[model samples]
Target chain A: MASPMSITALASDTIINAGAVDYLILAVYFVFVLGIGVMASRGVSDSVDFFLSGRSLPAWVTGLAFISANLGAVEIMGMSANGAEYGLPSVHYFWIGAIPAMLFLGVVMMPFYYGSKVRSVPEFMKRRFGTGAHLVNAISFAVAQLLIAGINLYLLGSIVHALLGWPLWVALIVAAAIVLSYITLGGLKAAIYNEVLQFFVIVAALTPLTIIGLRKVGGWGGLTDKITSAAVKNGTSAGDQLNSWPGNDISGFSSDLLSVVGIVFGLGFVLSFGYWTTNFVEVQRAMASDSIASGRKTPVIGAFPKMFIPFITIVPGMIAAVSVSEIIEVKAGGSVPGGSSGKGVAYNDALLYLMRDVLPNGLLGLAIAGLLAAFMAGMAANISAFNTVVSYDLVQEYLVKDRDDSFYLLVGRIATVAATVIAIFTASLAGNFSNIMDYLQTLFGFFNAPLFATFILGMFWKRMTATAGWVGLVAGTGSAILVWALTSFGNPWTLPGQGSAFLAASVAFVVDILLSIVVSLMTAPKTSAELNGLVYSETPREDLVDANEASHPWYQRTIPLAGIALVIVVILNILF
Target chain B: MSVNTTQKQHTAGILDIRNVIGALLGIYGVILTLMGLFGDTETDKTDGINANLWAGLIMLAVGIFFVAWVRVKPVVVPEDLDTGGDDPAYMEKH
Candidate 1:
């Protein structure tokens, strides 16, 4: 009989003896990436070049970077862990949660953003609501990016320390230095180029692991068979693991932690739309495209690759759920069990387990390099977005309005360094989090959930006033925080944190919408001239470049690409 | 101070930065893949899966394809593009 594969033994042994060949490959990869950063820096002369790639990026590059910005080590590792822990239901994040919002961003929102030529998302807020709203958004956005980047850094450092047996501080500092090396020199251009490169690296690394892991479990059908058998032998049913809406129930341990209702509204509509549409970290890539039409196509082009990412990301988790036991140790909680793989696979370590046990030495090095690249690029994306908002929306707008391009360029570089350092510091404080994915989503709820409401009213509704915009934002953010604190710390709650996060966001979004409407009616609405290009109805007809978009060739248009992605998503959902 | 801030340097379309990096990575990827596939079978870190060979081969192909794609359709710079201090976009930011 074949020896039983224990996750702990394999992982411990593999980390200890990763070999010199792998080390060499990693060194070479680092040197090569640094070289690219140096070369990309040659184009930098002004703030625009540093912050937005001089607005010269093509659709394909920006599109790839757009998605890659989100494909950091945390996302890859966290999603994979969720996949193993939750099974096929985990794919709800990609299919139902992500694709629709991406499509909406491309088809509906891009025209206004690109046509108006706002320097940042907060600038759009400023144009629509006034400086108060701008200050609120810019400060919150900058802080959000800092927190997210720090979490990514923390995760990357932990993974490195675990895999290489290096000190976490050493890993963090080295990674931080590498990130600053490129971004500080080339700014957004380097970040974008690296993100595009990292995108390929991620695909090259993870796709093979998914295929190999599947083969080990006897393909998709076999994998399902194994999971069901494993569950049955353990005296439980694979009800929720196999079905997306398992048990027709959303709460409790019925396949997924959240109910179908929660998944649909909280994750799919509210969270997905909030992140994909309004989050500057992802949208900045699309806004950097060379032309208005090209900018519009960025998210659409990204959506095609995005729809299929779950295969490489989540499938491994499903494989690990059945194949690897004792992947992680969970602490005691109301919803969580107090043991390692006692209830299920240790989700965070799913991809790492696969890396240690499945990939051979030479390929293992490349895979690890891919993981590292993803982490770095993810950080770069956040830093790039952070620095831009700091330089343009906050510093230049508020502090030094009459500064020249070179002066602001210097400020941008200094801000990049400052923000990255702060992120590194914040990353050190992220150790106590239970799940990276949950932590990230909760953070998103705190801001994006309410920001989405503000953006929606400001963009589509002509009657939304500046007073309404700022007041709604403040009120909405306050409500989100209040709900979070009440549920988590102040009082005992029935719902899980994720559920509370979703519900809190829903409340904030609703409150913001009602507040905006009520306040706008009470206050004076901006006249047509003041509202031009800011509000949808009041936007000048010529500014709507997409009005004649139908006349463009089908291949050159955004609608067809979006239509294709929607069809594929529907077909996949039905078939699966 | 003597140089024009608005002017962008003209580079060959086939030699776009993406293509260059892709080509370099592809070359290295192919080397690692070949070593993994045909070299000594001793000391495989990944239990039984030849992850290096597959990942490297895929990387090589993708790198070459990106390079080829750029060669086929070179990027043309819009000389009169208004993307500077005097451009309408920046002028309205204030």
Candidate 2:
């Protein structure tokens, strides 16, 4: 988000003038956030206890945490913004882009992560492909977390700036310190516990806003009618705004068939799979569960909540598009003269303006607190993941090998502080963007897509060599960057939504697979013994599962749960 | 029993996620309900109903349900149990 950083105003105008009750409610929420950290700290006696919660959390706890960890600024604000701009095609992000890949992670990929027992994703890479690939993965993963965390931190500061009429630097420092205290005090346990609490708070805040917004428009019928007419004014049809399928407007393809292909192949398969399966922010929650079964069920349990998230997130954005005057003005090729950013009205302002328009004093405070919790959850996920990669993968592996458990635990705490401080600097780098989803999608293309290509191919194909791993990742990332460079920056081609991002990811995935095959053919592969638990064909079935697996109920099992979720998602798609 | 003191049961359930969620929602519920009754309801801001009161009552009900759930099924934290190390031999031995 900060790449083309040229704007100076962190925030010029305040969006929410929170009253005393709003402040009290927000205060209570913070106390609980800190309290969770304190309680979680009681459980931490060793490095494992700090880094992985000693893998002590139950499936349900981890499952909720898994989803909560993701209910951050990106999912809430970014999706709402998408909904405001793209309309119903935005649900494609939740349904087509996320659910299948999440299920795939639970049923197919999680066993390897749990069975192999790596603290981080980069550590998993090291066990499979050796030093070359592990080093590349660890560095890139660490860098990516820092950059994303900055985005979350900046948004959090913006929320604070909106609440009180505080300066951006003061708000940034205060918000960073609050997050830093919790992560450093209790490590991953604190972060996960806070995330679970934050999730419920987020739901409680947004559900009313959505229902009230719908009420303001009369009902769902009224909302659809209003937005439908508004779409005509905006020069797009009702189908373009309301329907999710064959979305030519979303995929940046002039033709409907090409748009569907671009959406299904690019966003759904490569980018979604890359983020869910390989990204350690999500994977860490699953890894913290007590057993392999619990770990596997983590994502499966989350899929239930995840599939319905767009209702609260994107629906409110759609509501704002019709109801909020500033949002409407921006939609019809105009800008708010004195918008919050001091630039103009952006799609990101949809939720905030809608809150102002509909919510009264008490509920307004709850909504503001909910937004704060979300931004904190997002930042905590990034910082926690960063510290893990730093202490366990980078520090232990290369810099300070053969350290005592206590020493490494200390290193984790220090890394948490370092990340928060660094994020404060990078937080300023992100200028006001019209829609943040474009930047996020582009980042995922550059990082996660290539990494997913490497992991998926290497895990299935026993013939893939160690050298091919690093070569494929580097080449794939470079290609995605090149593709993005050619398309953006005053280029001839213009993508409607996140088409360039999708194109970059698809190109990266194809390039990585092809290059891995070529490189693996030239290089000698690792022996079957070395690839045992890492590769699917070489490992026995028993090595990848809970040995006492049959005792649990059907709901507790991964296969049955994922199957049920997939069916429900299919029904949702048809109904919508 | 001494080892399980970190997860002390009879005291305030601060560590438990359900309790935290329930208690937080419960407090907000009470506040909003009180506000609905005594303070400004702002019926015009919402449709015609007292939104704070209705939403507050609903939140209170859900919060109490969670508290009752914790009572029905207390989460037992396994203390000082031997953790399964990453060694393949330990897994194979089982």
Question: Which candidate leads in lDDT?
Answer: 2
List, residue by residue over B23-84, the lDDT tens digit for candidate 2: 99898888778777877877786777687787788889989988887777665544333232
Which candidate wins on TM-score?
2
Runs in model 2 deviating more than 4 A are A1-11, A431-441, A490-494, B1-13, B81-94
Every model's TM-score on chain B = 0.58, 0.70
Write model 1 residue lDDT over A419-485, tens digit each, in one string: 7899788776665443553455465556887888999888888888999989998898889878766
Candidate 1's TM-score = 0.88
Best by DockQ: 2
**Tens-digit lDDT string for candidate 1 (B22-72):** 765786677677766886433443446555666677778777887876666
State residue A86's C-alpha deviation in candidate 2, in Å.
1.3
Q: Which runs in model 1 stand beyond 4 Å of their true positions?
A: A1-16, A246-258, A328-345, A432-441, A489-493, A546-552, B1-9, B13-15, B40-51, B78-94
Query: Per-residue lDDT tens digits of candidate 2, residues A351-371?
Result: 888888777778888888888
